[model samples]
Target: MKRVLFLFLLIGFISKAQVKPTIQKDDIVRIETTLASDKMEGRQIFTTGVDSASAFIEKEFSKVGLTYYKGLKNYRQEFVVRNASANNVIGILPGKSKPNEYVVFSSHYDHLGKEENGKDKVYNGANDDASGTTAVIALANYFKELNNNERTIIFVCFTGEEEGGFGSKFFSESINPDDVIAMFNIEMIGTESKWHKNSAYITGFEKSNFGTILQNNLKGSKFRFYEDPYLEENLFYRSDNATLAAYGVPAHTISTSKMDSEPNYHQLSDEVSTLDFDNMTEIIKAIAISSESIVNGKDTPTRVQKIR
Candidate 1:
């Protein structure tokens, strides 16, 4: 009875800013191309290429007018691993009505580096995460333009995901998970999902009501969200969201990568040419629209069972 009442009220409070915030496919292309370019050396951690990626992300955050996270001087949140340095780029758009609550959007920027002597030396991870990282930037731009969120929105591009979830682990430890209302950890949305275009799946969908709330908010749109179908692969435990999920936060990954049949899963062939920018743009729009209630502090998702 309480659940039904909450849904009814949530549906009633649909965003007054019905005009979709601008999220251009062209902008996505520009960022994706730059990140996947051969010059970035596939953005491997501890490489000059990784440093370049971090700088690029910081520039985009600045362009979007995002303020620094937690009073940091810049977006580069530095941390070390095995005596080598890797940094996550984070930007913030503080909320007005509910400043204490937090909503996070994130993706990993690290990937496998180039082959030493191969003809196609670069492992351009366009679809693997450039697409996801692009979505993070695009979303940040969108929300900042809207400028009406009630819960603080954080945008972060994590490093060392390929090496293991090093960046996310460091970040999760730095923040109190209880303050984080929800986390949207995007990955691999460049290709068509198993459900095809205009659709994406959420990892750890059943762990909390996050997916349900998202789907409910998207009811009027053509886009749809499905549960992660590759249960045997244990995808929920993989990627950047795992650490926070263990902390009982409602953190989930959104993706369209088909586990068994992804042709470019980890190949050097994961270039920008393979992505469908139109479809990717729609997915970003869907997320922005669906998350309106949460961002504005109108909806609160249940916590994940804390992993001990």
Candidate 2:
């Protein structure tokens, strides 16, 4: 009886240990507040907004104690695509054991710049991706606090997602694809989903085993993960994830976008006021937990098969 009781205690301890880090609500609020602030000008590509967003990310990286990729002096991974000056804000949270293999968490910070009317100038894409951007920042902080991952976690704030996914495209080519284990591209998760109130879907769900792994990891949680319903939207190829997915990585976008009927998507009214803070916090937590397996090198999501 004593031996059985000891075994039970050990299992309980392991279960508690597997629980992922929690992203603070205040942290999420501050990140979103700063990213969506008017001074950033909606983070438009090739504009002052983009520059301001980059600065914010750089500061956060420094604050989180993340290191620049080894052998590099700076955190900025500068690159260009299509004559447009773009960059990927790269920072590394080295693994405790396997410091080379990487699990990349990314979100594009760029949005539609100024509107044609020239009067209502701000195209504040709060939900389109600021939600995702803020979440990435929060995740970095959470992991930093945990301070224990077996696989390097690469946090990237991508630019030019709205302009042809050029930022990620450039980044995918720059890195050794073999070293990258998976890519979790957060996008448009500010709103509630059509399924469960706190549910979200992964783009290109059928193309890779990533979705299955994430869903199984999140079992018993209120959140439910599903295939992107707007497949007709060709959403798999629509976001930054597409760039890495094209390279045969298990790259997928996590989102709550109801593209077929979203009233605020890319519109002037897509402001921060419409977001559900509590729900957003829950979603962030869910992502944190779902990714715990990957972060620890305990589970390797299946790679995407090359599409002909």
TM-scores, one per candidate: 0.93, 0.90
The global C-alpha lDDT for each of the candidates, from Candidate 1 onward, is 0.94, 0.86
**Candidate 1: residue pairs that collide:** none
For candidate 2, the TM-score is: 0.90
Per-residue C-alpha lDDT of model 2 across residues 1-308, encoded as one tens digit per residue = 99999999999999878565677778887888788877888788888888998899889989998899755688777876677676778888999999889999999988987666666678888897899999888889889888778999999988988878878887887787778899999999989887847799999999878999899899999888888999889988888888778878898999998888889998878888988888899999989888889999999988888652
Give, for candidate 1, the lowest lDDT window spanning 10 residues. Answer: 12-21
Instruction: Name model 2 segments beyond 4 Å from true.
Output: 1-21, 82-84, 116-119
- Candidate 1 on 169-193: residue-level lDDT in tens? 9999889999999999999999999
Name the candidate that leads on lDDT. 1
Q: List the residue pairs that clash in candidate 2.
A: none
